[model samples]
Target: MKMTTHQPEHYNNLQKLCRICGERRNKGRPYHSQTFETQIKEVFGVDISDDRTDVHPKYLCFNCQSQISEPSNKVKEIIPVEWKGHDDDDDCLVCDIKAVVRPESFAVPEKPAPKRRKSEIKITVVKKEAAMKLKELNEHIVCSICSGYIVDATTVTECLHSFCKSCLVKHLQTRQTCPQCKILIHETAPMQYIGTDTKLQDVINKLVPGLMESEIKRRNDFYANRGLSVPLNGNSSRPITPNTQDSEPAKFPPDDGRTWFHTNDLKMSLCIEPVKKELSIPQMPMKFIRCSMKLKVEHLTKYIKQKTLISDEIELTCNKKTLANDVTLENVWLETWKRKEAPMTLFYNKKK
Candidate 1:
């Protein structure tokens, strides 16, 4: 007979097993003809045609295909299976397809958290607008006398001008007018017209941070430069206790009632010369009186103004020389009145 031997069943039915899950099925079954490259392209939306010639056609069942296709939740679960013949290949078709398709599904090891410190320094940034406002406000607090930030600030009541206390004291030693406004602060005693403006000082302290401490240092430096002790209360009028052991005792007693003289270390007995009718002083000559040698010529001028009710538009002279307001009694005594007597004579003339 023509039909003799039956072909082998193995040759008749070509059965294939899944390379990934090892699922076996006959040729006509659902996934028997499925390939790793085709399945990757269909399921994972990955095209592996360029690398398909280099890779053998790997078979996969429906379940294994779905596992790799929808690996969003199973990325960590799916261990990369190595190819049987390729020892160097750690990645399987499922993992390769997943990496090509949804790379974000892989679990990247989380970075370790940064170490925290116990103390964290915080920086404060001031805005340009706020800084500008502070700068603008600072101009008002500056002293007109020294053109510096006011320290131990004093104000002229007549013109309402502010200055540092030392600056104003030094200014008034020569001038009776305000440094800023040129207004007459006092005809005779400008120092008496000025008072401590604590309100302004407090305002400055609030406006300028660290200003009070710096001002204290400046005042201390001033005292140090003059070889004088810094006053505890910062009042110039406050008497500094002298070192009695180092200083010689005063020849005369302290003039406790006198407000003009600072100390009575040296004394001079003055004789008032008889004034002419045209002169702006007393018509009759006055008696001799002891005075502090530290007194300025201006102090004598003020005294004459009080006693004789003469106008300030008058000048004092000794030996035909007009006495400067800054001239001290000791200097005048040494220069002009030394050879006269224990009681020296002084003359006054009207200012032309």
Candidate 2:
């Protein structure tokens, strides 16, 4: 009785078929960059996936690769190369069968030992397409206080939530908690804890087209109207010291209406700037004002009204909170003012 031997499957795919167009790879290039694969699909209008129905041939013959690489108009002449190559070892042309081979002469070849493979990391490419609206990204870019796109973006140190610098400053005058997260920005002084969020502000500027230009114009107009120089820094809301000789005030009128400080009175140097559209005496917008600390809040108000000559009532605030008519500047200095520095800064808006 004659015995037929079975060979192991390792004999398969020692030479792979081309992955792009199924052809027996002889002088073909191995699959290298995914870019070529993408080009093949885009130019040829043929997905490489169909050719890769089986695992054997993950390479590309030079002919097909060259065809895919050439410009589309020029490449239309050659490709869609019909290479329906076979994968089975039996189909190998090297083992050609002569007519009437003797069974006894046929011997199974010894399988070579498998080589050790080095560890490798495989990377994959993922592509997803979707649509998103500008409003959806409010948490990252919009100010919770203004309910608008953030300008001069500022971030709270305590909770890390961000808002427009002016809006947050305005809100922080009355509230101690973060507008978005309700986290305690500061138990005492929130402004001290917050700083410019440069990166976030940059991103916000990019996302909103023409927003930066509009803001620049608005700020320039505010400074122009108030007879104050707009700060070169993007933080335009902060108070600036008046430029003068002998510490004389810049925005106020001549010494006639300026406060007469008593010899013993504790004077507080104040930087009173305006918010958007905040009107001053037109002639005397408050850039730098000198007042006695012992005076009541009403005295300061009357002093400003008398000096500016504006008949309409005006409102003043430090840290965005309004001052009471009866409270003294000394109390505001000792208690309400947060900065431990020379000038006590304040912001004012039209009485609303």
> Would you list the clashing residue pairs of candidate 2?
17-57
**Model 1, span 1-352: residue lDDT tens:** 1221222322221223344433342234454224556656554454545433123234455565666667565533433222221124333332243432234433344999887675765668987753357667656798876777888678888878888877987787567788887888866445557778899999888888898777656666666556555543332322224653313222122234633434413356787653465643464346566677678988887777667776656677877778899998767776666445667777766677
Query: How big is the RMSD of model 2?
Result: 21.4
Alpha carbon lDDT of each predicted model: 0.58, 0.60
Q: lDDT value for candidate 2?
A: 0.60
Instruction: Evaluate residue 260 in candidate 2 and report its C-alpha lDDT on the 0 to 100 scale.
Output: 36
Error of 2 at 296 (Å): 25
lDDT of 2 by residue, 295-324 (tens): 788777776667667677777787767998
Instruction: List the candidates' TM-scores in order.
Output: 0.32, 0.35
List the RMSD of every prediction in angstroms: 18.5, 21.4
> Could you say which candidate leads in lDDT?
2
